[model samples]
Target chain A: MGRRVKVLLIGFGSVGRALAKVIALKRKIINSRYGILIDVVGVADSKGMALKAEGFDEYELLKLCEVPRSGVNLFKPYAHQGVDLNILYSNTQPDVHVELTPSEYTSGEPGLSNIMYAIDRGAHVVTANKAPLVLKYKEIVSRALSRGVRIKFRATVLGGTPFISTLTSMRSHDVERIEGILNATSNFILTEMHEKLVEFTDALKMAQALGIAEADPTLDIDGVDAAAKIVIISNILERPLKIEEINRESISRVSLRDIIDAVRQGYVIKSIASFDVRGGKASIRIAKIPRSELFAQINGVMNGVRIRSDATEVVFIGRGGGGIETAHSVLDDIVSLSFEDS
Target chain B: MLGRRLCVVKIGGSLLRDSKSYIESAQKIREVFVENGYKAIIVVSAAKGVTDKLVQVAKGSQEALRHIVEKYLEVAKELNSVKVIKRVNEELKRLEIVAGAINRSGVDLSLYDFLLSFGERISKILLVGALEATGVNALELHADELIVTNETFSDASIDYISTSANLEKLYSSIVDSPTIPVIEGFIGSTIDGRITTLGRGGSDYTATAIASLLNIDRVYLVTDVDGIMTADPDIVENAKLVRTMSYRESLEASLHGAKRINPKAFEPLEKFYSSKLIIGSWSKFGTEIVKEIPRELWGPKVIMNRASQDMSYMAIVGEGTSSVQFIRNVLEIIDRNGIEILGLQSYVHRPSLLVYVSSTYELKTLHLLHKELFEGV
Candidate 1:
């Protein structure tokens, strides 16, 4: 009621659909609960963009998500064809830009370009994509902070279930160590292999069939997905950690013999993301965890984050990476943002 | 939902697959258990279809069982847990020897249960280790240790009194602490401590038995089904979730061939305690089964059909077996329908009874019986 906040969302994938649903369904609740009005005025996809000066209809957006190709042409008087980053800044100005683009780990170009446009337009930003952060987190975070604009990415770390927020919340306490199973894809692949006795290729195929893994599951199976997650942890811990610097161990190294051997020894083989803060330096690695350890219980695509603080080693786990859960996470950020504005 | 209570979760074989959804579900379940300060006792089935494959091996030659052993070890390798990989190989070797004896000596059906038990034994070993790997305080309790049954090999009835005592002793070691107890589902031990099976989809029974016996609040049956639906989703186009159901309804629904809860599970639950049961997809909110239902808008007391009929008999299953009053009510409807009941088998361990009927009158009998018993007076 005080001031209407406008949001611009990029991409219309599953996460986008979920995000739209959350923003719409939880709007009244958010308003009464948090006392902030959020107006999603701009939405875009790979094929095109839609712009409404006041705000787009949430119901219409949800309906569009159901159709093939994601309702690119369905926003009456507001739907525009052919998406451009410039439209976010030039024609329909937005206060916050939500980046939900397809990931490009190597370059993070799509996400990077969107962030640049959002910053240039003086818009604060929230993102669920790990690509942009994996590639240029230091540069992007610094730029937004320097401009006095917030860059909230709770979804990036553990899909908005209060993971990074919880870790950062415990900043007052000494959190010297952090470890977990951060990559759902790798976990899924491994879990499938163990349960079904399916080969790696078969497990990967099953993951793709479920749409949990990308067609090219390199990032997940190769441990890059966990790497990106670890990188985020390092940054949160204020450690100068680079993707290349971290010692990576992919689940691909796990042979059929390895799994069989591990089972024989009464142990589980979990792909673990661990961090050690010592000598004022932090290092992250992917290890084959033993069943006797806490990390071993983590199965399938679940992401578990354990923080070893001065008091207790708290573990947080959930749907680590899913469009629905990630979307909910982004909604949490918006709700928090709305509260802060109030 | 917020407070920490003792909770038992039974993960179905489908959700136990080595898939991201399965692992993620496991992690989420474990997280919820820890976050709310609930002491979790997780009973896990073999990964996905591993049990069936192991059963195939158990049925075949010893060479086939050896192959099954290799297959299990391969899974440990995939996760990169060398310790478990080694231990499972040795255990499988012993199982392989048993398989050899079964094939060489007369293959006793009881041996099938013993040989097939390895699948879940290996699974518990893997799951507990996996939990520990994630920094969750998890311990493995061999299924046979806590789940006590009679000498019946394949479909053994549980020794509830003994099982409860064993559970108490085991819980004494870890209860009130953060340690999670991982157990093998569907497998129990004879009074003499030999391996036995509760039956297919029987792991849920084990979980329910433990949950109810321990007076836990709820038993989470994490399965492939999203929740209890009006009909099998594959068959009914308009099938939607029945979000909240009574224990009676759940027993009826599942016994009438609902994809989630095993009918046998209702026995231990109904007898010792009426714990809440939530059966659903591995990582999603599911239908909650309460002990009692308000009759306001609820439809029917039971739903039954001959899921499968042969020349020999009909299978009439649902909740309320021990309730002779309820049983009499159902039989009256069947009698009024003029259906010929060939054989009726009821388990003291559960609230389900299977009635064998002549195949010729099966359809007519079920149709009339559905209206009389399910749509009820």
Candidate 2:
């Protein structure tokens, strides 16, 4: 009934496939509810790129889910394999560019370059990748603002469980401080240590087996992931914090003995990530929280963020680090961007 | 790949103990199906001890995680493909991320199912690699993407209509593809995409569901055992394999503590489409369960000892088990043997008769019934 929102998906990994599935399955519902139909015009993965001017059909989208290589194979007779991203973008004019490339925190190469390219090309950007925002949040935000395009990164934190959107919506209430379990992997490991009486390394190993920890878990265990989240939340709160400025304490030092001792003292050791608006500082550390506290009860792969504001103290808790869950948030941003244009 | 006969083969967790078995299984698939011009959809479970270890990992045993990674890595090494090994490593890395999250976060049943799924997911990848190494074109198909279930978490039931629709759509897409789709069993997903597992021993259910959904003729449930035995092999030295059984009889055996086939696996065959279920090991063609039994085969098929101390004999008779003549014959046998029946129950619809007796006369009763029903005939 309304204008179709043309979209270009930059990554065809699990999260990308998940987003495509959601769009295909929920197309009718989305169109009826939001008055906009999503037309996925282009999709690019490591293998190559697939572009269709008339938008991919449901069958093609389903094929993309099973494609072993790049989604370019989904286009079959009409696909342009191994096409460069810049050329692909210029050829297929999509209004919204959905970036889901893997995060590279240190340099933010691919995600940073991809976002900048999309913004420069006058296309609105919606990203689930956190690296670009963590490395260059202010620069990217300012660049997008200057270009008169919008950038939504709700999926960057809490796997798209309304952490950023909720905080931004409460901007009218003058928030004083924010603290909770921002990183699900670290929180899960800490909970495992306390409940199962295993050492930190053991807990981390279990997390890895369960697909909750990355192979290189330094970011999660060393508090870098939480610090990045704090930086993003701080930026959104108008405090603008850098990754280097945030003080972090890794969870690797936590032991079963420490957990037992804390429990004996009627407390739980939680990997708490916090931001103090007054001090303009963010910190991630293992804090002994009371057993009855909200953060103490938040356990495995689930993230909880407590916001203390002048109006109310609110706690947002949800299952984190799922491809589909994160994709839902990315889709929500894409829909929001489309609505803004209309 | 066009117009090839399709068959769904399920490999039980027990069969994947060592690298040799992985190769053996690929060879078996090639010999029995692929060479015969049939396309195989392989459904696999986690390695024998992997699921248990993963459950431990979920509960916070970091040691279990190392074993899981090492086991898969070892299998990948045996496969010896750089692409396959890299894929396995990537999956292991992803698994670490999930496990770490579960360890840090408190356990939710839904999340636990998601955690448990890595076992089968990783196994599927390894098996696909092994199959490809054996020169069979194979692809890993995550069941969570195809099988739709309710939000019941650990023990979820499949939504037949939606699942059937998804399977049909998936089949149509891959029907012409040359690659054999290797799928993970025991795990599916809610419509909203949260992971949910069909309960333990659910690989058979997955295989059967796929077979019936695709309207395939037969499904092979490859396990360690030869097939459903006449009696517990450990208890009875002369226990013999039963070649054929009916769905109702299998269900009866399952309910009375026989762990051959999952009871849920029969739902698709009984409700939607019919398929022959062949269960056995590589060396033996053990049991074949069909939709209907012929008239001659309609009698007590399996004599099971229901309990150890206060022994009870559950006679799983075939169709017409509730007939007046059949009940009379059973009573006559017990009376003639001078066996004391403490309690007795029989269902008109189901072909099962439970006879309770004292521990002393349990063996005697089983012997007499077996002699009268099976041997005498």
Candidate 3:
């Protein structure tokens, strides 16, 4: 009722649905706390899009959350044919564009093009989709800057907390090194293997059963997910790194034997991602560290990061990869952007 | 008439068996509530014996898990909706994965609770499918998403404050609309989102809790039986149907081993008393129960034979049943009938009395008590 921020949403997967649920659940609180009302002007899924020029209400958003997986086109009365991002933007102009398409590291397709279209329209872009940001953070940021529009992707990396924003605020110090357990699926498997004395295959199966790991966990186990976060972190630190620039070692390399051996020596095998700012090198490896270290204590689906600079070192830790957690991150970005003077 | 009169109807597990049964139940709801200008929140239990099968699977029963997957898939196929079938298959696939993990690892209580919950969760889907197939618009509200509870794994209690807030917020938006929301019963989630079950026979508890919290006036605990009987029908051939009962009498009757009721259900009704519970079959809905019994109806409503240690006892349950006058009358009856008893125990605070007797005379005492108290002999 105070100030309304119109948004166009791209993607309707788990994260997207969770975002809708949270928005519907928090509508009154958000309006009261921030004096801002967020109205999703349009939503695009793989099948098609749904649009309303005045933006959707809580009831519509809640219904959208229940739409079958990739079945937004089935939503009646308001369901529009085709998922062309350009059509969505042109139909009803939005103040902010939120992109949540699944990460497409190689091409960042759809998301890359969708985000570029939003920026071209002079709209502030808030993206939880890591593909576009990982590929062309500088280009995206520069384009948004030139257009005098803000781009917030806090959900792209360590989104469980304000990791990127904190890093930005510490620019006054001479940055030295960064290390973290960035991938929740890999971390969960490692934790299960260590605590339960299970083999690699068993641990991964358990992770899959528990939904910590996806059906095809190649991206997570092969360290590609960690590498993506590292690339995003590197870019945030103004290092201008690319996704392919970071070397990745699969966490699968660690076996039950390795874990036992590590435990015998008061150490644990953890999938750790590191960036040496001074040397300009970054990689995610299966590293062995002493049992009492902060990274060793980071277990299950919880992610943790350690950053060191000339003045001090600090640790940040929280849940990282759940849809609801990432949805909150996306919501926070949307709300923060809504408060800024246009 | 006045803004759609509201009621809560809980379809018990006994009323759900095959796809046909689910359809029949949905039709009954449509005829009784939907078509009657009423807005009802339908709470449903797992299909008959599904929870037992899941309990076995949770205890490492290999055969039961396969039975569950086949049974649910078959029922979903019978529903004939591709969308419903797909969703049910996905849920069963997830269930299989969780079961596999539980089998690999030793059984953990938390996981066991989550495993047992598949019964209600899957049934909710099938029921929703059934409702839609019957030309009734229904929505599936997974109990995990709404029924917030304490941290107990198998016997969790609903945290009314949190659950009330959730129900008010979620249901208010749709209560005025024509579509109905069907929620799974006997299951809730911890505040942290871990699945917890409300013990067995807890579906009635779930229904009453919603009615009490939402301030609805009536709850139908739809089961296979025709309301509460004066005695166990299997034991006593002349058992009569109890037309009415006080909330306390039902609670006491259930506590003393009376058939067809769960003592756990009285918590919400006792605390709030905002709703009345009617227990019966879908065809014949009768047996009204409210917070207080009328003075004329404040007498023994049921008699049950129960065993404690090596002693068997006959329990008489009703309001004002623990008074000295009633005890004197019961003693006079035992004397008149030449029925020997070991002891009689009653608490003035509770509306029940336990009359202990030898096991040989247990049935005799129950029959005599039913004849004298319930049959008005």
Candidate 4:
């Protein structure tokens, strides 16, 4: 038998649900190719916790995805209400803990507590949640380092493509600056506002309808989501900055007249996240991009990040966000962590 | 935002014959709607004969994909929008891939439906380009993602509840937005995500459904003809336009095989919002269809000469054709003229009355009915 990796899923929202579907679909290929079989042994939602030490099969996992929001307790046979995390952890004994809770910036909520618990149990952690990392990057990473248990969160920054490994592995550490369209919601809104001459509110409504923006899009519109990504990047590059350090202009200030005026000047207003590492400053600005540039080409719900290093500059673009896209990134982190010298 | 008025418009295939035609239609939209300070949601059909071309490709026709790509790109190039050109090229490439994949896997009805969707998909993108070119800001909405339908691939039935919810989510805010969204007509996706078509002449259905579901009041269906005519202009020497009719009358006329309107287009209009439909060319929007008109305004709006399998029919379609007085008038005229009637069909519930006659008198019957009921000549 190949390496059997047991996973525990916490928080079953859009991303969590997408990750489950993706894992079920790609399990066969992953098992056959990498000689590793994934078994999701436990799932936790707001209402309750569901545990099956033997792991959920494909059909059950799919059925689990169909459950109504915060209705994990409704899942039969293995579901229970108000189950303690300690007992839940001991029951499943998961090899890898996957936390996909919503990112509540202030307290970092359930994701922060869940990640801490997983680290204490010496279980590897793979996260799609950015709040905890953006809020407590050094504390979390150093804790995982001391525990000798790996923590991978590539999904937080890269939607469905590789970026963190590439950024972290690059030599010659003399990095100058970084600019990216990191947040999908803001990018989609800006693209609509500038290209289609839509107002900021209407563009945001479009984003919400498209499922690119959550019901409460405060973090995205306020530029915290992009700043969070920058903070993660800064921490990775060993030049950490507080989340508050990034001065950001809310995209809600954008108007149809502003976009129309920008078009007249052969420019498009884009929400750009810039980190001047040399100057030790990070800011999210409503920057005007020339029509002929690569930045202007990144429209809709696509993310593009450009790394300006000492000798060269590199750009990485991928889908900004979707449960399935981020799930693929999450799966990669799991597979790579399984292959580590444990 | 509520200060801006909204209407839905469908640019028909007959009008979109060439690149210049697309630009002209865009200019008409700008002059009529945008300049008049009304925001519009435009539903566009494929260029004339493109669906027929797609139908041939669906039946294993070879090398036709390139021609389709060129046809769409022709308009894109004229509009001079790089963004539109790029989108059209990408969609065309996807079409080619879908076509190639179907060829490799062998063709099926579902895949055939998918192949057919490209015509409208490409048309919608080009229309957006054309609209933007005319200084009217517009965007393209993908119908396959938004319009929900049943799994019947070739002749799909729309799930109005799901489709309405989706449309309301994406398009409900259009009045607040500056740009008009141009969407593809005659195409939708199944609840399980298979592409589908809403049968032939279904573009009108797409337009009316969007209007009714979004609670928008007016729908303009721009065709080559001026409006709903009394008789086929080719068949009768002096046929006049039917200026106004009810939704029920329009649906009845269409069911009797009227040429201009689609029967399915009235379902949501009558069932949901009862939006008014304007069926005509851009310059003269002649035929106005409301959910209901005053009873006095209910009479024959169209007379058609139809035949199926050697049986000839002169269909006199109107709002009050089933009324006792109107039926008496029609019978008296037929009797006085000595017209040989094979059969007759009329129900109190229906708005149309059908009279079966010999093929020899089909055109004569159509003309006689048109003169008496419409022209009063």
Best by TM-score: 3
Error of 4 at A253 (Å): 56
lDDT at residue B41 of model 3 (Cα atoms): 88
- Pairs of residues clashing in candidate 3: none
Kindly list the per-residue Cα lDDT of model 3 for residues B312-364, writing each as its tens digit: 88888888779999999899988898988999999999999889999988888
C-alpha RMSD between model 3 and the true structure: 3.1
Q: What is the two-chain DockQ of model 3? A: 0.38
lDDT of 2 by residue, A176-276 (tens): 99998888789888887877788888777777655578779998888888888888888898888889998899889888898999999999998888999
The TM-score, computed over Cα atoms with residue i paired to residue i, of candidate 2 is 0.71
How does model 1 score by TM-score? 0.51
Off by over 4 Å in 4: A1-342, B1-4, B172-174
Question: What is the iRMS for every candidate structure?
Answer: 21.9, 6.6, 2.5, 20.6
Taking the candidates in order, what DockQ does each have? 0.01, 0.11, 0.38, 0.02
Candidate whose lDDT is highest: 3
Could you tell me the C-alpha RMSD of candidate 2 in Å?
A: 6.8
* Model 3 Cα lDDT, one tens digit per residue, A99-218: 998888888888998888898998889998888888888889899999889999888788788887788889798889999899889998999899989888888878887677888999
Q: What is the per-residue lDDT of model 1 for residues A231-255, given as tens digits with 9 covering 90 to 100? A: 7777777774777777777777776
List the candidate numbers ranked by DockQ, top first.
3, 2, 4, 1
Candidate scoring better on DockQ of 1 and 3: 3
- Tell me the alpha-carbon RMSD of every candidate: 18.0, 6.8, 3.1, 21.1
Which candidate has the highest DockQ of all? 3
Model 2 regions lying over 4 Å from their true place: A1-4, A11-14, A24-83, B1-141, B144-182, B188-200, B207-247, B256-260, B264-298, B301-316, B319-324, B327-350, B353-377
Q: Give the per-residue lDDT digits (tens) of candidate 2, residues B1-377.
A: 22538788999988999777788888888888788888888999998899999899889888999999999889888988665677678778777777767766566576689888988988887887788778887766779878999888888888888888887656665566677889999999988667899998888889999888878888989888999887777866566788899998898888777887788999999987799998898788789999988888887778876784655665545676677788888889889878888888787888888788887888777766765666653
Residues A12-81 of candidate 4: C-alpha lDDT, one tens digit per residue: 9878887877676567668889889899999988878888998887656755664556767767778898
Worst 10 residues of 4 chain A by lDDT: A203-212
